[model samples]
Target: MAAVSPSPPAAASIDRGDSGLQAYARARLAEGDNALGLAVAGYRAALKQDPDRVEIARRSYVQALESGDGALALQSAALLDGAGMLPRDGTLLRIGDALARKDWQAASALTDRMTQEGNFSFLSAIVRSWIAVGQGNYAPPTIDAKDRFASLGQRYLDEHVAYQALNHRDLSAAIPAVRRALVARARDGAALRLTFAAQLAGIGARDEALMLLPADHANFNVARAAILRGRAKEQPFTPAQGYARLLARLAVDISSDPAGRALGLRLARMATFADPLGAEPHIVAARLLVEQDHAGAAVQEAAKVPAKNWFAPLAQAELIDALAASGNLAGALALARQQASVPGAEPERQVRLGRLLAESRDFDGAAAAFRAAQASYEPDKLPWTLLLFEGSALEQGKRWTEAREVLERAARIAPDEPAILNYLGYAQIERRQNVEAALELIKKASALKPDDAAIADSLGWAQFVTGNVAAAVPSLERAALGAPTDATINEHLGDALWTAGRRYEARYAWSAAAINAQGDVAARLAAKSEEGLKPEYAAP
Candidate 1:
């Protein structure tokens, strides 16, 4: 989060100081650092020298947007547009600015330009339709456009149309659009479901809306839909409210794209502005900021959610994570405790607190919190994940007997859970208990998750301890391939190789393991490399 300098700017040739290096530094700031203000300063200096560097301009624009400095984004965008050099996202930036001003004509023109340039293909048509709806010129794009767009694109457009109608209080018009979108997507995306729920509530079918959204789904959309259903009798919906949901949907749709997170963050920020009273956008923005490791920013955004909001608990949970991630572990722990003490906190909130405690190595506290979460579940339906967390925490605290008891219960509840299987199997093998049972559990786990390096190592070690040294060799070799730099896996492979009569490979494996080994592991690996495997390790 700090603004540590990436490198000293080159003193020579200030007029042409490798813009690429400055661009790279800017990128690192966007993708890693929390210091957008400092990044903006550096980007300005670089652009002063290399004014036409489109990439630099683009990064600067996004940094400004993420920092809540729309003025800077618009300024950088204007400069790029004036230079007749638009980056790939330049049009999106300009269009966002235009829509913010309610300048429908300007927004339409920007979309037209993007379409003329063949930049975004069907995206332009979608934007144009939304712009028209924003201006009350509801000339929806023709059905023929559906053929030009794939199912996802067509569904996106349908969602936009439904959103537009809802924004204008035309529930009759929205119903068909929502139906088409849902049918096209086969009822997949959370946002789509949320939209349909809102439409149903708007039509006075509150029961139907409640049925459309599952109560067990722990997300902002579902929470928002439930709120809408509850308020259907008293609250009046507005176009701005509709636009907020639309922006939230767009934000969700783009959040998974590696290159689209920045854009998604910007849209989420817009959603917040669209309806400041709504907590969903703030939650989404906080989540995205946390993913970028901008924990300080995430905390600020999450703290904006009103305490009385139904989704406030979710926001608070994220805020706690942000605090912990930003090195304020004490503050995070205190907040988690407070949330847990609330009269009716959700079970997931307690689970989150337990995970945080576990990550911070307060295993005893983690185990207690996880146990509390488990107690909250109905006697007939305990969540296996809660039991697994409790078991893992107990194991970390060296309470082997308690851990085994809880893990065995978890195994019964969710027999196919890979993590539970792997942890219990590995622990049993380490304790030299139930070798045959551990092998079966680990083998099932490996089949479920064949690519997990840790599970492979466990499977190999189990085979070795059970006197199947020759069989262990292939498993250990596979584990080493997947986790070449894992010291323990390398050591296991070395022992397996030595037992299989591959002395040279065993030494090589031991040496590789020693490279990154530490403490007792380092000492043991070094000795293994120097003196070879012990006599007791030889195969029968």
Candidate 2:
């Protein structure tokens, strides 16, 4: 009791305790948990103990609001306003939300308060512009808001605003916004300006839009000169360089956007006439043509690439497939044979040739090609799937015993392969001696690739033959969905539909099959459909 020092004062101890509580609350908030409520309670309690801690309470409240708690956000916003710590934008955002909810007086008051502060005049103008647009009063306020954005060096925003102005037919507001964006970021912003200017020209601002070009950017300079000279078509200064640049742009644009890819394909195809030796353009043109369903045209385009290029074999194979698809099997087989005989042809060429030959019904030649191809290449490098082609050719040639042996060996090598399983299963089904075994093989194939139309069709057909017509319908329907344009799947669907007593739908499916089926298969399906119409139509 002599020199006790008064125990350091109770306020100091309370302040230290508050500091510890705030730190714990902040740490929990940082972990992204439900700490906003805890932080709000802690900050409020601390503020009660130390009323001077206004800034600390304001910060905690803001953090709680930003964590997506609308109730907490409103409460914190109120506390910040009470403490005089609310930023202008924060108040504006809250007011904007209130306005969106049709609280007109609150929004108007917030706008007036912000105008008085003079700190967020630009944002206030933008909000006012949006309100004007919403109210259908697109006059002085909209123009003023756009001007404010233009003055702030926000060109992208300005250009977008200009687009909105144009949509409203406010050419006066649009011109200034477009001009401001073009002037502020001329180099990187030329392309967008060119588009806007082209539109402005369409709306009778020819001189103004033309003036935006020739602004030090090369693309713009070229575009402006073209416009002034009345050149409706783009004529590049250096055709090769221009084509190269266009191709580069196309490549980048096509990476994520299909419409861009389609445009790029058209541009590349046009470029190919000028740059005949540039195989890159030809390859892209071929791919685009394929995507466009001009398979024959794609084959012709792909044939221009030299066989020595790395992509030559792939191009040739694609061309052959396309030719086959277009009902030019003879031509496809000839191209395959020519590719096979070419000097330094890769081992994969043999597989391609064999497959084409098999499709053309030259089974002995296909088998010989596959055998020669297998002998010359390493097993790892050889596409083991080619073995299925040899087996299929043998089976079609009525060498069933050998076909079964070869397919069984292929199945062992590629135990999990859906293609091999489907081929073997279908082969068994065709032989009509191992319906149960074929069903097992087809089921395995379907399990591996449930969405593969070819495998699904095989499985459904196998099930149908095994007297499981009800189970087959869903599989056939799924197959039809997966391969809407596939002739075989359509034929299978027709059979399933007929068995399910949907005779009209079955006939429609058969008509679709007749439209899409190719070569012998097409003929066979058509004949079968005709037979089904007869009173004595019988299943093979």
Candidate 3:
């Protein structure tokens, strides 16, 4: 991911002939250009004049890490440590460096510091285990049976322990750790299987390793194919790489949860420092950056994903969202179109395009893309949800005839789906077509999803449209009471009240509708409050 800039240096500071200030301005400009190499040099030079500027030093340290300048980063880390202002992730940086240099002594010291400072045990314990593995002294981290990521973490730890044991020719110890990691996540996480299988193969248990990766298992197919063709090799075993993988995965887990996102961002940045060539860390960082409303930075971060990386698809997906979040809908659409046009993936790629188009209100394009997604399926095997996707797109586009056919198809496929029933019934109610049948459909939907405000609204409106004003009054009242803030439901209630000759209460409902209504709906609600419903709109 690209290094993020803080802000442009002030104009007065430009080329001030004071070398430190000039270097600082240069550093800031380099950061703005996403040139971390130049930024690192500029910040390093500027820090000579004022190494204690917490802000500059911090920024310098960050750029060094982002640029994979280990020497520069460790130097900055010491500077920050001396000032007692080291950032939370600085310790991890120093630890990773120590492990990489094979200085297990220094790495142990760093881990001890993390433990003393009360870094989350879930993380620090795992880090300690890896440091021990690097030193050929394997100590399994204590398991937290309840930790959300414990299973995944142990799977990784067991891989390292097994790999190191294999190197030590201890088949008894290696075999158990290998079997445990393999069985713990047999159906997912290719990395675990790949790494463990490699250890067995290294120990000349080739047949047993092959047994762990059944070629027909969907999860193993890609790895199997790559291995067969000699195009892929299992990751080289190193405690440093294992540490990076753990950090990257943990960053993803934490960032995915809203409450943990703040710390997740820091871990993501540090993961990049840990694995400079990695793709996952960049994507995770980009996603969290976008959530924090830094879309431009996210775009830069995601764009750094190598085009040929296995995660290229995910990176592109992130780019589309980041572009859209930054209000570049046109760019988003363009990228979505390019991805959807890829030859093989079918439904997923096309569905992405359809959703993007639908969200942009280009329902015609959405309908077309969704239809294309169904081209791969046999008529009898069409997924009901995909049909509903296409139906809803057509419905929103005001193509009712097209929408009704597809939606009815979906309802047949999934007879108990209340949302499908409500959507189809309400649409028919709006057009006054087969009102009696539509009403029955809505009644069934309401029975299935008894408390859904929208379904209740549909049921009441269908009653009102069928000239059952007596029944509509109570039904509409129930719907309105259930969804007090729904403009459409309130308007329906207003219509029923006016038909029942309750003029004052009718106006009150109309006023309520107008409160949150917008565009033509708002105007119509306001007019109804003043002029009352037309006679034609009233039920007999």
Candidates 1 and 3, the one with greater lDDT = 3
For each candidate in turn, the TM-score is: 0.75, 0.46, 0.63
TM-score of 3: 0.63
- Pick out the ten consecutive residues of candidate 1 with the lowest summed lDDT: 7-16
Residue-level error in angstroms, candidate 1, position 121: 5.6
Q: What overall lDDT goes with each candidate model?
A: 0.73, 0.61, 0.75
Error of 1 at 130 (Å): 4.0
In candidate 3, which residue ranges exceed 4 Å CA deviation?
A: 1-119, 123-125, 136-240, 254-266, 375-382, 433-518, 529-540
Candidate 3, 65-167: lDDT as tens digits:
6654566777888888998988767888787777777888998898888766655444666777778787777775566778765655565566556666665
Which one is best on TM-score?
A: 1
Report the backbone clash tally of model 1. 0
Q: TM-score of model 1 relative to the true fold?
A: 0.75
Report RMSD (Å) for each prediction in the order shown.
Answer: 6.1, 27.0, 7.9
Stretches of candidate 2 off by over 4 Å are: 1-264, 270-276, 287-335, 380-382, 484-487, 494-540
Per-residue lDDT over 1-540 for candidate 2, one digit per residue giving the tens place of the 0 to 100 score: 122222222222233445534443443353243233344444444545544455655655454432223444455567678878876545644554455455555666786787777754544554454445445555333334355444442323464566556646578888887677567544324345555655565555667767765543333444455466655332111223222223323433453366655444534543453345655556656666566555656677778877644345555766777787668889888888887776445556777788878777788888888876776657666565667877878888889999889888888888899899999998888667699998999899899888798898888888887889898888888888888888777877887778888888887888887787677767666776776643233223
Give me the displacement of residue 275 in model 1, in angstroms. 6.9
